[model samples]
Every structure is written in structure tokens, then in C-alpha cells.
Target: MAQQNGMVEKRGAGHWLTHAGLILGVLFIFFPIWLAFVASTVTQPEIARPPMPLLPGGHLWQNYSKALTSGINAPVALMLFNSAVMAIGIAVGKIAISLLSAFAIVYFRFPGRHLFFWLIFLTLMLPVEVRIVPTYEVAANFGMLNSYGGLILPLVASATATFLFRQFFMTVPDELAEAARVDGAQPMRFFVDILLPMSRTNIAALFVILFIYGWNQYLWPLLITTDPSMNTIVMGIKQMFPSGDDLADWPVIMATSILAMIPPVLVVIGMQKLFIRGLVESEK
Candidate 1:
């Protein structure tokens, strides 16, 4: 009885430490965002003042106005549209293609199946950064530059997402699939009716993650789309810097940056449940 009580005490202490660590981690992650929010409302001078105002200032509207109209660059609204297109395109494309591919990998038996899996899996290691110049050259050579295709097409398939979905699919019991098969279900029917329905949480989670990945993209789109009209919110943020006669305003820049974060933030928040479900499923 005494030994069991000692064991219970040890478990209680462990749980406390784990919960405390998680709270600290959450605070650490949110601190930068809180700082950015405070900075977004203050003037440049106020930002660098000897005593910074930790509180938010009242310049939000004025700063946003400056950011919205400062250049040949697309307005924040237009930039949001571009980002939305890219995000939705990549999200839909990656999820659809990867889902079907992962399903095939787990459920279907075919020639070169393992080879095909490895070939796609290899792409995760060879990121776009490694092939940036080659990809750029191909885009330039084919005259696919400066278009939505240039921005979205290269990212339509994600090896990481494919692997993630594949791993998750492998966890689903073959008995469930064989049960479907016995019901005269076709391949498409089994996938859409049985598999995908069961995978709804994971799919929604991956969608949010992929959408955020597209929205936060900076370098590739910047390299490809030279046209000002096609600028994404990220590119527009870059355009808000100091020029020969233009002032470099911190509040405006921060306002734009914070505004740029809204959609992805909302997405992550809304899909928090799905995200947790994916993590739990992956672990299982």
C-alpha cells in the first residue's frame, strides 16, 4: 500500500511538470505576436523611444491606410486575393493528389509500387530550395513565368503531405477495407465512401496546414512574379520599405504584417480540433 502511494505521487509530480512546460511553451510562442501587435500601433519614433509603450497605440487605421496605398504594388485587399488563390489552389491540389496517391499506395497492389512511393518520397528531401535555379530556368524557358501557373503549379504536389497521408492510411485496419470490398464496393466507392469519410479529421487538418504553407510562401512567388499586379500579401509587405524620398514607418509595416497574418491565424484556430486529431491519428 505504501509503495503504491509513492508511485501515485511520482505520477502526480510528472503530470504537473508536463502541464507547466506546456503553458510555458504556449506563452513563449505567443510573446512575439503580442509584441508585434503592440508595435503595430505605435509610431516609428515611439517604437525606438527610450521607454517603449508596451500598450497598443491608436494609429491602427492611419497606418493601414498608408500601407494600402503606398505603391504600384497590389493593395492589401488585392494581395489577399492573390494569396487566397495560391493558398486554395495548393491546398486543394496537394490534398486531392496526395489523398488519391496515398490511398493507392496503401490499398492497391501494382508493379513498381514501392519504387513509385520512394520516388515521390525522395522529393521531401530534395526541397524546392535545392532546385530553385533549375525550376526557375524551366519556368523561364517555357514562358510560364509571371503567371498563376508559375506560382501555384510547382507546389501542387507535396511529398511530405503524401507521406503523411500514406502513413495515416496504413494505420486504418485492412479488415475495414475488406469489409467494404465484400459489400460490392468498387475501388472509388471504397475510398470515397469508407476511407475518406473516416479520414475527415486528418484531411481537414492537412488542408489547414497546406493553406498556411501557401499563404506564408515568400521566396518562390517573389522570384517568379515580377508583375506588381500579381503580388501576394507577403510580397506587398516587402514593397512597404524605405525609398529615396519615402519614409520607413514601423507602424504601417507592422500593421501590414499583422493584417497579412489574419487569414492563416484564423485557419489554424478554426481547425485546432482537426489538427489535434491528425497528430493523435499519426501517433496511433
Candidate 2:
């Protein structure tokens, strides 16, 4: 009894320490965001002055409204819309293509199947940065510049997602495929009815990750979109900064930064449960 009680006491102490550490970590990460929110709500003088205020101010509506309607290059609302379209397009396109490619690789017995999978896998080494010059030329030839296709298409073929889906499909019992075949279901029907339902958590996980990836893209959008109307929120935020000796608009800039975070935050929060399950859960 004494030994077991000692073990319990040690575990209890460790548990408390873990909780305390987690709380501190949360505070550390959240403090900057809190400061940004406060800065967004206050006047420029408050932020520029020493020892910035910790509390939010009354200018929240004024700052955010100005940011939404009249940003430095383009309106925040328009940039947000452009970012949403790009993010959704990238996530959905990557998932769809990966699902089809992974499905064929796993379910079919075509010649060079392994070779094809390996080819796709090897492209992981050749990310967009590596091929940016040729990619830009191709997009230019296709007249995709300043378009959503240019923003999304060149970035959507995710080797990691393909590999993940292939691995998941492999784990699916062969018996299910056989059962569906015995029931006279076509390949498309089986995919739609059986595999898609099983892959919901995984799709949710990838959607959250890919959406953030797309939303945070800067270089690609900067390269492709010269028109201010096509600018994404990430680009808009950077553009909001003064180029020369001009005084920066701290409140509006901070407000734009806050607005930039909302969509990705909402996506992660909405899909938190499924994202966790997809990353950790093993069973189909």
C-alpha cells in the first residue's frame, strides 16, 4: 500500500506540473495575439508610444471598418474573399486529385502502377519554388495570370496528401472491396459509398491543413497577382506597410492582421474534433 500510494503521489505531482506547463505555453503563444488585438483597437499614438496598452480600446469598429472598406492596396473584405476562394480551391482540388490517384494506385492492377506512384512521390522533392520559373511561364502561356486558377492550380498537387490517402486506402480491408464487387457495385459507386464515408475524418484533417497552407501563401500570390483586386489577405497585410519614411498606420495594419487570421481560425475550430481523430486514430 505504501509503494502504490507513493507512485500515485508522484503521478499526481507530475500531472500538476504538466498542466502548469501547458497553461504557461498557452499564455506565451496567446500574448502576442492579445497584444495585436489591443493594438488594433487603439489609436496609432497608443501603439507608437512606449509600453503599449494591454486592454482593447473603443476604436475597434472604426479601425476594422476602415480596414474592410479601404486598405492600403485593396479592401480587406475583397482580399479575404480572394483568400477564401484560393484556400477552398486548393484544399478541394488536392483532396480530389489525391483521392482519385490513390484510389487507382491501390485498387487497380495496371502496368507501371508502382512506377507511377513513385513518380508522384518523387515530385515531393520538386516543390513549387524549385519549378517557379517554368511554372510561371506555363501559367502565362495558359493565360492563368491574375486568375484563381493561377493562384491554386500550380500549388494543388500535394504528394504528401496522395501518399497519406494511399496508405489509408491500403488499410481498408480487401473484403470490403470484394463484398462491393459481389453486390454489382461499380468502381465509382464503391468509391463514393464506401471509401468516402470511411475517409471523412482524414479529409477533414487535410482540409484544415491545406486551407491554412493556402491562406498563408505569400510568394505565390505575390508572383501571380499583380492586380490589387486579386490580392490575398496575406499579401494585403504586407502591402499595408509604408514603403518609405511615411508613418505607418498601426491600428489599421493590426486590424488587417486580425482579419487575416479569422478564416483559418474558424476552419481549425470547426474541424478540431475530426482533425484530431484523423491524425491519431488508427481504425478505419
Residue 104 of model 1 has an lDDT of: 91
Total backbone collisions for each predicted model = 0, 0
lDDT against the true structure, per candidate, is 0.81, 0.89
lDDT of 2 by residue, 62-95 (tens): 9999999988788889999999999999999999
TM-score per candidate, chains pooled: 0.79, 0.89
Best by TM-score: 2
lDDT of 1 by residue, 1-284 (tens): 56667654646769789899999999999887877788887787897664768788888777777667663356666777889999999988988999999999888899999999989978877767778999999888888787888888888867877888888888998898888889878999988888888878778877777788899999888888888778888877887676777556668777778989999889877878876665555444
Point out where model 1 deviates above 4 Å.
Answer: 1-32, 42-53, 66-72, 243-246, 276-284
Candidate 1, residue 157: how far the Cα is off, in Å: 2.3
Candidate 2, TM-score vs. the true structure? 0.89
Clashes of 1: 0
